[model samples]
Target: MLIRYTPGRTGLAEGLRRAARAVLYLPTACRLARDPGYPWLNAGAVRWLDRHLAPAMVGFEWGAGRSTLFFAARVARLTTIEHKEKWRRRVAHLLARRGVGNVTLRFVPPSDDPGRPGLRPALWRELGYEPHKPEFAAYADVILDIAEASLDFVCIDGRARVACSLNSLPLLRPGGFLVLDNSEWEKYAPIFTAAAGWPRLDFENGVWRTTILRRPGGANG
Candidate 1:
């Protein structure tokens, strides 16, 4: 599916404000880049997850990084999907070195064909992480192997996030959380529309927003 970004909401003021915030965040971003175990989420979101995530819960995340170690430490088990080969190997080393046994890391590279089904080129360009081009339909679809409503939480911080978010909703147990990092982007508008009734909480920061949406209804519903 070709998911187009809606640029309508991000006017000149929003652009300028984000640019200013990006400048302000440079120091902190630099520090975070050096720390491999620190999740790239806004600090408020990290605190929220620290408070809410249980030791017995199972979680899945798109884009593996320091967050892999973070979630693996907190949750009973974590399944992480990554598209980069070298990065995946590095994270795997980190997991082994740290003795984090709860994570199952999978490397699902971008599709060789840009015209492959469900590929979203526009969304990928907006993400701007194209070391190998933005064909992550298969990467996002990796979650489909897990049974529906089985996940306690799903985090979308990687490529093809809109598609990942769409794929994640049904996989979450009711009241389960869907965490979206960099939620301030206009390209992710579809998730809000698709998750219309879900209760959402935003951990807002000047540079980026981390959003959490709880699936509504009973646990089995």
Candidate 2:
């Protein structure tokens, strides 16, 4: 025989207490969750960082938005690149609002037009970054068509699958890290093939494929 018990006063009170705690914590959790910066990175990338590159000098995020803000807070220095003026301003404002001072946001102009070869010169100049300093810049069709080759960690959450992979390769140090989002895209298959020799971890769940590539050397790599 079984006894079916409904909530009596104490049970009801306990349930109410749990509900109250959830409600009380809801706003804070929501605030953190909705923060304009720091939306979750790919799980594999996060794990790789925790294991390998968390203590590295600095990191460059190729498409400045929420992720850039998040990474800036965690790293020693964060250089974020966005091509659109509007997004650049938004990222700047968000960083300021979040009291994040280590982030340097750059608005990279289009270089696809042969006439605009020097379009990004002013941005680098304004930032006082030497031509040799490691920097990441985004383009509509490419994550980083041009950047320094001494990058510690490169996050590719932008466009131009093949171009991004090619441009990102040189940026990594011997034991650096590279992460690419939307790896499930069929067009990026060749890029994966190119990276076959590197140590890689991948996760695909129908909608997205996140691939984390470690440069060939060192503990994390």
Candidate 3:
């Protein structure tokens, strides 16, 4: 069964109730260790992952940036795939400045036509993230080429999210995690169901919806 994030904020009283609950119940320590200057995953997801992602594990992400640094600190090695040269270069500089040397970044060009079904929808303005299509398909291929079951974690938070999600499923090691950010979009409903074999945890923290799906077995802590 799929767990959905539907917060019903009917009025001020109801909103305040949630706010009060958050102050009392939410775990503040699970937030990302540091602010990386961009939107990352939600707090609950961060907390869960921080507790579970051990330093010996290896990780990968479809798009790189603040997340590159974020995961690098937790995992032993991290590889990032990016389709934009400009973004890749900028992220590389930040990584260098921060002295994060364990990450490998590969810049793959957008190979597919920009127009395609399930490719682009008008979710950019509302969700602040857009799916990169044909180019994304190419990027997904690079991730698929990674040795099967070799990565301990994979994050499909960048463009071509769906394609990356499909490819990432097999690349993860048993008990590994596949994290998809901005998962509340209606268009991504299929992804949740398709990931049937894994244990899925959905988190909604007012600002973003993040889904952490695990491959079979216990999470590597």
Candidate 4:
């Protein structure tokens, strides 16, 4: 298989490493090709999730992608929200191809309130993000409406990630996890402070950094 990555997007060495790792985990690669979950996750993060993400777990993700298929297989219920029509269709096809039925995918474009949060540099430093787009801003309510202490896992990897993280926190059940991808970006530092109550476990996988925050589950009797 030929692997081509843009120069600025990633360096040759890192690309080669990922290719090698993908081959090393060929079995996982195969599984991911069908339904992505633990096998393709960062080894450390996978280990933690494997030990904790029970079959009956329920999860919600801000962005729809491979993780959508990932959680669909592991949990009893999984809800993923996406703003991009193309991406949503791709994920839907993956689910249908795998014959997996546990996941629900929704299209909630950006909100249109006053400043158009996505375009507000003060609220979000990034431009043209889902949060900034009037078409994608409505997604905030999809996540915000989830009842408190209802979700077993949450992945904030979409537009307005910091804002998404803040909204996701309340839905996590005790012992639930919230995964924040691209943790290495300095712009996301506010998430750490905002989510201070959750125990943070950071892992660097190739060029990406993923931070897993665990909601404190009170001790068992």
Q: Which candidate leads the pack in lDDT?
A: 1
Cα lDDT listed for each candidate: 0.79, 0.60, 0.73, 0.69
Candidate closest to the true structure, highest TM-score:
1
Candidate 2: what lDDT? 0.60
**lDDT: worst 10-residue window of model 4:** 119-128
- Report how far residue 94 has shifted in candidate 4, in Å: 1.6
lDDT of 2 by residue, 9-36 (tens): 4676677665665554454456557755
Candidate 4 backbone overlaps, count: 12
Off by over 4 Å in 2: 1-36, 114-149
Worst 10 residues of 3 by lDDT: 117-126
- Candidate 4 deviant stretches above 4 angstroms: 1-41, 111-136, 219-221
Residues 109-217, candidate 1, lDDT per residue (tens digit)? 8875443334333433444423333476677767767788899999999998887887778888987999999888788887787788888889765656889999897
Error of 2 at 152 (Å): 1.1
Judge candidate 1 at residue 145 and give its lDDT.
75
> CA shift at 221, candidate 3, in angstroms?
11
* Residue pairs with clashing backbones, model 1: 1-118
TM-scores, one per candidate: 0.78, 0.64, 0.73, 0.72
* C-alpha positional error of residue 64 in candidate 4 after TM-score superposition, expressed in Å: 1.9
